[model samples]
Target: MDDGTRLGQADHAAGPRPPGVIFTMRYPSDVGFVWKTIALHRDLIARAFGGEARCILAYPQLSPTSAYQPRWSTAIQADFYDYSAENRQRLERVITDEAIRLVVFMSAQPADVDLGFLRGLGLRTVTSENNSYDHSLRQPFMKRLAKALIRRVLKRQVFDLHIANSQAQYDFLRGFAQLPASRLRAVRNGVDTDHFQPGERTGACSTLGLDPDRLWIMAASQARPEKRLERVLEVIRAVKDARPALPIGFFFVGEGENLAEWRQIALGLPDAETYRFFGRQNDLRPYYQAASVFIHGAFRESFGLVIAEAMASGLPVVATHAHGPAEIIAEGETGRLVGRDDWEGLGKAVIEYLDDAELRRTHGLAGRARCVALFSITRQAQEFADLLRPFLKDGAGAPY
Candidate 1:
C-alpha cells in the first residue's frame, strides 16, 4: 500500500500506471440502501488503501454533471445496456482515462451489463450477489423464469470473481449455479457503526412527531411481498389485542410496490392509530434511534442489511430466523430469532423486550458491541482490500 505522502503525489510520467477500481450499479434513487452501501464500500476501500487506490462509481443513468453527485472521488456515466459501437468506444475511453483495472458490479446484474465486453478490456471483474436465488425461484412463473435466465446467463459470464453477500448465497452459487469454489467468496454485508450508534430518542421523536412516552417497534425495509411485512403487522395487532392498554407504536420506513397495500392493511388493524408509515425516508438514523426494538419479517433474506443497521443502532433485533439474521443475531445475547412467519413467537419476543427495560438495554448494548467487532464498515474494507490486493498491478503509488 502507498503511504500518505506517495498517495498525494502525481502519477509517474513513465510506464503503464497501476490501475484503479470502479464500482458499477444502476443509478437508482438515492433513498434506497443499495446506493448507500456502495458509497460506503467505495469510501472504505479508498481509506483502506491509504488513498492510493483510486475508487470511482460508474452507472448507466447517472449524468456526468448531475446535481446530485455521488459520494466518491470520481464518477462516470457509462451505459451498460447500450451495446452500440459508440457506447463501447466511450466506455473504453473511460477505462483508459481512469486506468480502471477492476470493475465491481454492486447492484447491476449480468443481464444489465455486458460482462464479455468488460472482460475483453483485460480488466478483472467481480459481481456481488445480494439476493437469495432459492427464494427467487419460488416467485411466479414469469418472474421465476426471468430470475432463472439471469442466473443461467450469470453462470456463463466469464468474470474474475463472484462475491455472495451471505453464506447461504455462497452455497447457492456453488451448488445451484455450479460456480467454481476458487472464484467464489462469501462476504457478509456490513453497516457503518459510527453512523448508526445509540443515541437519545428525544431529537428523533421530536422531528418525527412521535410521542416520547410510547414505546416504539421499528421495521425499515422495502415493503415487498418477500419481506413478509404482513406478518409483522399481524404480530403488532396480536400484541395490541393482548395488551389493550400498552402504549406501543410501530414505525415503518421505506416504500415499495406493496407499500400502499401494506399501509391499507395496517389501517384495518384494531390498533391502526398506533402504526405510522413514513414512506421512503432518505435518512433512517432517527427512526432507528427512536425505536425500542427492531423487527424484520423477511422470509428468506440473503443478507439482511437492515438487521445489521438495526443492531448497529443499539436496538435489539427481533427478526425471522432467515439466513442473514440467523448469522447476525446472537440468539440469547443480542436479540431473539423466531421461525419465519411465526407471529406468535415474534410477538412474544417483542413483549419480552418491551416489558423489561433492563433487558432491552443489555441486549441493545450487546448488539452494538457485536456490530463493531464483526460487522463494521472498517472491517469490511479490510476484507475487500485483502481480496483485491493480489489482482492489483505493481506500479508507483499502487495499493499492492
Candidate 2:
C-alpha cells in the first residue's frame, strides 16, 4: 500500500471502507439540518468504508453561482435547466469519465437531467423522499384527465428504487406508487447524539430572561401555518386552565410565514409568558435539553428529524401520531403519540407526562435508549451501505 494513501481494508480500527459512490445534495456547508446530517454521516462513511459519492447539483436561475459548493468533493454540477445538446454531451462525458456508480436525487433540488438520459445510461436511481400524485391532479375532470395522461408516460426514474425514512412512507410508495416492495428500503433518520442530550445546564430559558423554574413545553418549528399551531395552543390553553399557577411555558422556535399570526394567538393564552418564541438557534440541542417535553404539531412531515433529536436529548416526545412519529416511536413505550388533528389528546398526553415526574424520566430514558440502539450515525451508514452493496464491485456484495 502507498504510505500516504492508506489501504481501504486495513486503514484504521474505526471500520473498513465501503466501496462505490454515495450521493446527496447536502454538503457540510449548508445551514439546514438536512445538509448537516448528510455531511456529517458522509464523513463517517468515508472513515469506515473508504466510500466516495458524486453529487448532482443544479442552481435556480435566481440564485448566485456562489451557492454551488460541492458537498463532499469536486465531482459533478450542472444547471437545473441548462441541458442543451452541448451541455448534455458534457454531462454524458461526466457520467462516463468519472465512472459514477449510482445517483441519489435529493427532493430539495429542482429536478432536471432529462430522465430519459439517466435511464439510458443504466444508472441506478435513488430518491430520498416520497412522492404522491400532485393534489392539483384532483382539481377537475379536464385537468385530472390531462395529468392522468401525462402520468402514464412520464415515469419518474428516481421512483424505481428509493430509501425512505419510515415504514408508512415505504408502504405509501409500494401501495400507491406501484413500486415493488422489495425495492423500497427503510433508512430512519438519526440525531447527532453528541450534540443533543439532557442536562444541558445552559439555563437557556433563564438566559433569555424567562423564568428558570417553569416547566417549559416547546413546539419547535420554523412556524408554518399548516403546522396546526392552533391545535397546540388549544391544548396548552386547556392544560393551563386546570393548573392555573403551573409554571408551564410553551415555546415556539424559528420564524416562518405564520410567525405574526401565531404570536398573536400566543398573546391570548394564559400568562402570555406561557408562550414564547425563539427564532432559529444554530445549536438546537440545548433547547431539547432545556425542555421537559418536546411537542410537534405538524400536519405533514416526511419525518420529524427534530423529534429524533429531542428523544436523543432524553426529553420524552408528545408528537402527533402522524406519519413520521407513528413509525419511529412505539406509542406508550418510547413517547406519547396522539391522534392527528386532536389537540385535546396531544395536550392531555403532554400534561399527563409532565405531571408524573417519574414517568417523564422513564419515558425519556426509554426514548434515549431506543435512539442509541436503533438510530446511530454508524448504523445509518451501514444500512445505506447495505442498499448500495448490490451495485458495488462485480455486483456480488456491497463494498465494505
User: Which candidate tops TM-score?
Assistant: 1
- Global Cα RMSD, each model: 5.9, 7.0
- How many pairs of residues collide in each model? 0, 8
Candidate 2 achieves a global lDDT of 0.62
Q: Across residues 107-225, which tens digit of lDDT does each residue of candidate 2 receive?
A: 42225446667657655556666332221122456754554344334433334457777666676654444444555687876667766777743476656655668888877765676
lDDT of each: 0.75, 0.62
User: Residue 175 of model 1: what lDDT?
Assistant: 60
List TM-score per model, in order: 0.85, 0.75
What tens-digit string does per-residue lDDT give for candidate 1 at 1-400? 0311112224436565556887765554243454566566766776676655677666565533343344435555565556788888877877777677888776445567787887787777777777654444433667545544544444454357788887888877766565656678888778888888888987788888999888999998877888888878988888877777789999899888999989999998876887999987656788898999999988788888888888999999998888788889999899999988688999999999989999999999999999888888777877877777666655422122
Tally clashing residue pairs in candidate 2: 8
Which whole-number lDDT from 0 to 100 does residue 91 have in model 2?
A: 54
Model 1 segments more than 4 A misplaced: 1-17, 32-34, 63-72, 81-86, 107-109, 135-155, 394-400
